[model samples]
Target: MSLMCDARDIEVNVTWPGGPGTNQRLEKVPSRFAFAFENEDVKGMEEDCWGFGVPPGARSYGWFKLLLDKARKTEYDVEDVAGELTNGLLELPTDMTAKEVVTAYLTKIYNHCMEMLEQRYTANILITTPIDFWLTVPATWQAGAVDDTKAAAGSAGFGTRDGDTLNVITEPEASGIAILTEQAERNPELIKAGDNAMICDLGGGTQDMQILTIKAVKPQVQLEEAVPGQAGKCGSTFIDQQFYQWMEETFGEAFTNLPKTKIGHGSKFMKDWEGVKAAFTGAAPNKQYYVPLPALGQALGATGDHGVASTAYDFMDNAVVLSGEDVERFFEPVVEKAFDLVDQQVSSLRRRKQGSTKLQIICLCGGLGESIYVWKRFNDFCKDRFKGAVKLFTDKQAWSAVVRGAAIRGLNGNTVLSRKAKRAYGIGVHRPFREGIDQEEDSYHCPVGGKRAVGAVAWFIVV
Candidate 1:
């Protein structure tokens, strides 16, 4: 059966099976939400609500999932949440918590998808066919974050209709399903039973890796985890963060003191940077990239130095010139961390196999995985390390791999045989107290049998 799902990073990608004349449909919404309150007492007014890929103003919130993950273990406090908001280009109503902002953002995404579907087909299709939602989350997420995600999805109206369902899977697993399924269909011989492959999903917010061994290829593709997944905050967004830091450092107060309206989410300068970032490949070391800063120019006027003389940067024609070398520097540290994660996973796979087999393939997919430069770096590293023993592959539709895979998994059912747990799961219990082993504070009296015991844990699953 066809299904609807979304893969969320710095943006949310929604995909679903198409109607009679189409194959599939995809929509991308920035993980940004904005609300205009009529007054201090009102919030999320429908007329004042909107979402965009690059939000129109500074009041919108982006990268909120990361914020939620950070605050997962802490108690929710409005003031504390406000402090976290200050770190980013986020502005929220003082009364709203981070979770509330997330819920509103998700709800906006859901409504947008439904509106598209209704326009394509009749609205009656929504009522006749139950839409199952399959969401992808980062492997590094904690239990609290997962639960919160589910709650937000539900609150956003997913799985609320009759016969509808909601399912959540780690991002790496979802990408793996899509990449492996496509590979098996196109070149079955490239992967075989007993072969191992590493799937790296490099999105805007995080890089997640998983190693899986092909269990079977015929009839249907099957896979089992060769090792638990690994992830880090080494994603494309970190590149943006580094670039912003460089801007501040190179320009000094000229950049740092700019008004939010000039440099906020949808400003011309930010929009130009987005294009520059997307096209950067570090292929031309001597080339210079210019990002126009008309607003900054007007603010500083003709006499201002624009801080170019003191640094390696140049300001000409109201544009800031960045060298290819400087842009590559912004990407190196983040890319290195992703490479390290792959190294760790490969090392574990080698130890597990004990030389019986080697990593036969490396699958890269996600928004950042679409980078030519990233692919080149990975290709070079894999060639040197594997010595022509491994094949590096990337999907043509890397940006939507996770969402597409979620749709495929929903239609074909799960092909994974088993998965390794990242952490242990257990229940707390009371065991009969040992005379000297049990601490005095841990001992408890059992009323039913009048027995002394100490609190302990029974682990059902181990990582």
Candidate 2:
């Protein structure tokens, strides 16, 4: 499932043999949840008043998963979480803690999936057949955050039924499986065993890059990591942030002075920006794009410079007209960060192979991965650097690659044979203290033998 602000952010795809032909069904649900109150009496509201809609005065808590991840290093408190929430485009409710908000959001998604399943195949099927859940998490997520996700899923009733199970895999791995499987089926000649291919999973909030070597093509596909994965917070959401920043700079007080309650998250201005963002391809260098300014419609009159001169943009027809160069300014930085990640992985693979091996394929998958401008930039980079030695791969299903891969993994099984550690991990051990070598602060007396010892770290795996 995707947690972006897009309309088709959360998707549910079922693969069962008991249903109709192909036995596969897919549904896209808005990644939106709201809690509406009637006369300040929130406690008396039914469950129907919440979950999956844009009702009037309802609050949408986007990116709550980030808070769950943050809870790993810091304590989980309402005040801290509330502060983080308020710092964003949305505000948190005073009565609910961050955990409660996440639980509610997940539970709502779960219930909606279950209702769809019951409608597709009668409720009897749900009761009789065992159900297994496979979830995809960002590769950059910490182990503690993954555990938090599992706990939240359990609280949402997953793995609660008899014979039910839940499994979690990194989002890049899932996308790799789906893309490799599709490539193997459609064009087997494009890739073969022992060839290294880099997978770039660019989603809404994070970008993960990994290199994998094909192990076997026959008797089911198998894969092994060529190098450890790398990830960063440079995703499509950053582009949106850049867009908002541009609005503030270009429009001045006419944009910032707007009422926060009416022009904050989920506003019409953002909705229009989404359209403009998706349509931009950097294909026409001389063409211009326009985004409607519904919130600033009246403010445009007050500014008095609506049609006035500007090097990058102009205000006309109650909209902002941006040149192609202006649009590229919003996307170039984020895309370049992603390119840096890809370069790091490629450099690692080159070092491992002693500069003898060449990267055969570069797979791009996820929401931002579908950007035509992004694809063009990568294509040009590969041509100039690799001299056409690398083949770029992407598809129309790039946004749903993670969920589709999860469904494929649930139906079949894991295709990965081995993986490399992203970083070094070790255990702390007590060693006999050496007067000259050990630090005084690290020395401690052993309880078993009453001997002086020093704390030391034993590394088992190194990146």
Candidate 3:
């Protein structure tokens, strides 16, 4: 799921990794595909390919994340984008085709995987091997986004050879499947055939929730969406923004006037501050968090750490200190919104099922989903609201759960029987109006056919 490479130049001869040979089949296990790209060769051309992967340089890719944050946005011309990867509505800095970029990312991952495969089995055998790729997508992504992704994958030559196929699923659903699958393996009775669960996937940049219904547990456990998934831009990444702004506001000009270099101390502080956040557990943190700002002295023209010579301003010997309360300022805004989304999901299920215990488990997975603070919050909310009737759980494989769960889907394509529609879908058409059957006021005259029809209404299935 995450590609952490230090940017090493790849070896010419492909070799397998230290693990098992690719030819060996391990039943009920997920495949490992990524090779650590060490920092020496870590920064690469593809790193700048639109912001999905790590950025080559440091200014935050605000626009990229902002674009994905929306469930519906300016639609891209699918054919145009597909035909020419670089051609699209949004401005792109690089001339790399979207497919070229996607393919490059895929190739980087698959090349390592192939090397690992070649280690156990011969490269000749691995060359013709058929592999399934399961990619994760946000539940709220529009069809256009998915279309673009598939087009990119196809351009990347994925699922092209014999027996090769691409598989896609909602991120939250995949995480849920991984957790539920493991639970069933440990305890056969973890979930019955008709049990239901809610999966809250809180990643670094997005929060997604899905309701799953267990279908069967015989040959292998199968599941499907019981209701539409919900998602938003609220994720752990926002906390970094919160912490950053808090520093600027607290220290006034000193923090605000820091150097704007991508590798500056300010940026390094943010990179390190993530650890501080992961350690947060709903507890009042330090009165003043201290950070050694090496970039500060240089930025203000201060020869030494003691003072800024140009402005004759004084400063700490080696660090800038900030209040813990200021660092936490941004957390509640994002957290509360996420809590509300979860509440909506719970309400929908209990309201829909009404009579019986429909939701038995609330599984949290993803980057933020692994947070002790969030896990506790959801657990406490579930216990207080559901009175311990609903269970709260997360997995040790939370970070990679989405990708692994996706692999499970690829292996068992039929695991999900059906998915709930996110919204009503229908087509506009003219129909004969009846006094009792139709609402007279709602009827409209069809200009083409000269027939009566309903205006601005979905005539098909309504969830």
Candidate 4:
């Protein structure tokens, strides 16, 4: 099937806890919001799908526990001592109940997905819902950071970096739950027990590598409960941030001085920053703005400024080119490490003396993995180094693979995790190492003294 479509087809991004709902919706291929509201379409058939991470500070402790425990007996008495001691953690406004927050969170994720899906590509939705619940726990949740003990002890407790900040950290793991559940339900037979598979989830913000062990007869995938730091923050947002910073640095005074209008009561900040950036990046030579160019020029201290002129071309060229380059450089380290991971897995298999010498298939799925530059590098590396052992699976459907997988899992929850596989690989830093953007290899080392060592064994599960 032709996966490429016009970008306008995708209208909105819909996010839910990963599961059959999302998977079914993805398969339906929603290109408009009308599909979501017109029919009682629980699954967003006419919309493009994508997932997002709740700000590290907003995920629910109760939901977090439920996810870690796979919805087991994880609830605690709200009246207990620990609960009373941490009542402040549960003090969100009455209108912002946990459920409301979750729904809104999903909605925001959906909107983000839709915006990205519609930009520079054709699709109904871009799905971030992954089969793996990728999360990162702070290396140490000390007293000042959060009450790790209370959180672990089943209290609805929260922690923070500063005194007033609430640190209900939600890593990528929380985002994947919505998509995985959707996939597990659709393909019970193909995904049956004893099947060992690795999920390569490329999200907008991070890439998650998960190992799933299928049960002997079940359809569920066994997941590790612990957090791992293997994932990197190579999200596309880095590009946006770079662009924003560039704009700020180049035209902060002029841009900020533009008349500001609060929309929907301050929920949305509407200014012409985007217009200015667009006019600069677009092929058009000149674009007019509501705010006169002379005023902006005066603010920018430009010598002969007239009405909105064509200078945006130069501004965009300089800023966009730099941002693109930075995007590539930002991902280089992670790309290098990704190959290193594949090598480690391959080496492990070779040691086992398995009869199958054929290389394991390495699939690429996620926002970061879809980058042309990253994909080219990975494909070239695999082809040159491992011969045919590496396979970079890129289909039109690949971007939404995680959500589809998640949805499939959810529908098949009854049969999920019925299979098992041996988990032997450890995804952790082999040594403490840090290096500047262009530093030499010898410059990489631990900040603290002595030889760098593996910090911790990131979580993995057996099939």
**Backbone N/Cα/C clashes per model:** 0, 0, 14, 65
Q: How displaced is residue 72 in candidate 1, in Å?
A: 8.4
Task: Please estimate how well model 2 matches the true structure, expressed as its whole-model Cα lDDT.
Answer: 0.69
The TM-score measured for candidate 4 stands at 0.39
- For every model shown, what is its TM-score relative to the native structure? 0.81, 0.79, 0.69, 0.39
Model 3 CA lDDT for position 57: 33
lDDT of 1 by residue, 82-107 (tens): 13113443444578766777788788
Local accuracy of candidate 4 as per-residue lDDT tens digits, 1-463: 5432222232323433332244433322211111122223333334322222111112122222122222222111111122211222323334444333333333443344445546736453323222122113321122222333223322211221123112232222222322232234443343433333344555433444543333343223343322121343333333334443443454554544443221100111212322332223212223333322333444444634323323432343221122333334434445665665555445544554423333434456555555566567777887898685554544344455444443333333322322223344567654443444323443335557544444546666632
Candidate 3 error regions (>4 Å):
1-122, 187-190, 217-219, 260-267, 285-289, 297-317, 322-324, 353-357, 423-463
Stretches > 4 Å off in candidate 1: 1-27, 38-50, 53-55, 71-95, 283-285, 300-303, 306-316, 353-357, 430-456
Judged by lDDT relative to the true structure, which candidate is superior, 1 or 2?
Answer: 1
Model 4 lDDT, full chain set? 0.36
Please give the CA lDDT of all the candidate structures: 0.71, 0.69, 0.59, 0.36
Root-mean-square deviation of each candidate, in angstroms?
Answer: 6.6, 7.8, 10.2, 18.7
- Sorted by lDDT (best first), the order is 1, 2, 3, 4
Q: What is the lDDT for 441 in model 1?
A: 84
**Candidate 2 global TM-score:** 0.79
Q: Residue-wise lDDT of candidate 2 within 1-463, one digit each (tens)?
A: 5321221233446432122235434223334445654224333334333322443334455556666666232111111211211333233457765566667777876776788789888899978878888877877677767888888888988887899998898888888887887788777898899888888998766788888888887655678888888777667767777777777676777777886444454456665676788788884767877776655656766666555324334444666778788788888778888778878888888788432356889999988888888898899988987899999989678888888777777766767888877666688888877888778788777787565665678886532
